[model samples]
Target: MIRDGERVTLGDTAVTAHATPGHTMGSMSWSWRACQAMTCKAIVFAASLNPVSSDGYRYTAAASRPIVAGFRHSYRVMQSLPCDLLITAHADQDGATDRFRTAPGACRALAASSRTKLAARLRADGPAR
Candidate 1:
C-alpha cells in the first residue's frame, strides 16, 4: 500500500510509494524526484519481497501476485508520470533499454498498450489455467 506521508529514506535518495493494488493486498510502487521532475522508478512488489512463503522458497508465482498487480497499476500510473526512463528489478521479460528509448509521452502510451495486451491474456488464459 502507498504509505501516505511516509517518506522512504534510501541512502541519499528519498522515494515515495504509490499504492497500486490488484496483485495482492499491499502492492506498492515507488516514484522518485529527479532533476526537477517526479518520475516513476523502481517498483518493489510487497508479495515478492515478503520473507514468508508457503513453499519456503524465495520469490515464486504465489509470492508474485503483488508484483503482477503492481504492473497493472504501474501501467496506469506510468501514463501520468513524467518518466523518461524505466527500470526493473531484472531484465528477463520486458526486453532491454532499447525498448523504452522514446519520448515520455510515447513511452507512456506504449506501456499502457502493452498492459492492455497482458490483461487480455490474463483474462483468457486464467494465469496458467
Candidate 2:
C-alpha cells in the first residue's frame, strides 16, 4: 500500500489493488477513496495496484510456472482498471507530479524509469565474460 498513511478500512468502501509493472520487481499503483474523482464520495474508496511478473514469486519449478502464469494474468487485469490517479512508491516519478495527475500518466512515468534502470543494468553487466 503506497499510501500517505497507514491502511484503513472505512465501511467496506476503500482500498483496492491493481497490478502495475515495468518499473521494479514489485511495482504497484493505488487509488484513494478520498479523491474527488470517484463519484461515490459518500464512502472512502481506494485501490492498491502492483506489478505481475513471470517470476512474481520464488518456488519449486512446477509451482514457479503457475505463479509466473498468474502474474502475467494479473498484469493483464491491471490494464483494465481506471488509472487516472498518479500514485507511486517512487517519489521522483508519479509522486513528483502535482497533487493532480492522471494515473495512466504516472504509470507511464514509472515505466520510463524502469526502462532507464534496465538499460543501466544491461550496460553495467556488459557482455558477461
Candidate 3:
C-alpha cells in the first residue's frame, strides 16, 4: 500500500505522491518539477475531485464520514500543491488538452470547485437519517 506523502523516483525525476481520496479511497495525485535550462515549472497531475460513486452512496451518512473526511483533506492537499501546469484525471476537468497553456493556480481553482461540489452534494444528500 502506497502511503500518503511518499516520494517515488523514476530515473532522474522524483515524483511526490499526494493522497487525494475523493473519487475513491485510493485516489492520488502526483507532483513533479520539469526543468528546461533555467526555467522549471511545477506540474501536478491532480486526482479526480469528483464525487463519482455508485447511486447507493450517500456522503452525508455516518458510513461515509471517512470518505468525506478524505475529500476535505484532499481539497487541502490539492490547494497547497505547487502547480504551474494542471492536468486532471479527466480531460474535461480542466480542459487539459484544449488550448494547451500552462495555467498557474489551477490546483487552487480545482480544489475550490471540489469544495463547492461537495457542498452541493451534501445539500442534496439532505439530513442524515
Best by lDDT: 3
Better of 1 and 2 by TM-score: 1
Distance from true location, Cα of 12 in model 1, Å: 4.6
lDDT tens digits by residue: candidate 2, 1-81 = 453333445675465544443323244445445444545321111222222235333222453444334444434544444
Clashing pairs in 3: none
TM-score on alpha carbons, each prediction: 0.48, 0.41, 0.90
- lDDT of each structure? 0.48, 0.41, 0.83
Cα deviation at 44, candidate 3, in Å, is 0.6
How big is the positional error of residue 17 in model 1, measured in Å on the Cα after superposition?
0.8
Q: Please provide, for model 1 over 55-112, each residue's C-alpha lDDT reduced to its tens digit, 9 standing for 90 to 100.
A: 4332324765665566666566656655555443334324445433334554365456
lDDT of 3 by residue, 1-129 (tens): 667888999988999999998778798899999999899989988878887578977899998998989999998998888889877888766434542236667889888888888888899999975
Please give the distance, in angstroms, between residue 37's alpha carbon in candidate 2 and its true position after superposition: 8.7
Which candidate model has the greater TM-score, 2 or 3?
Answer: 3
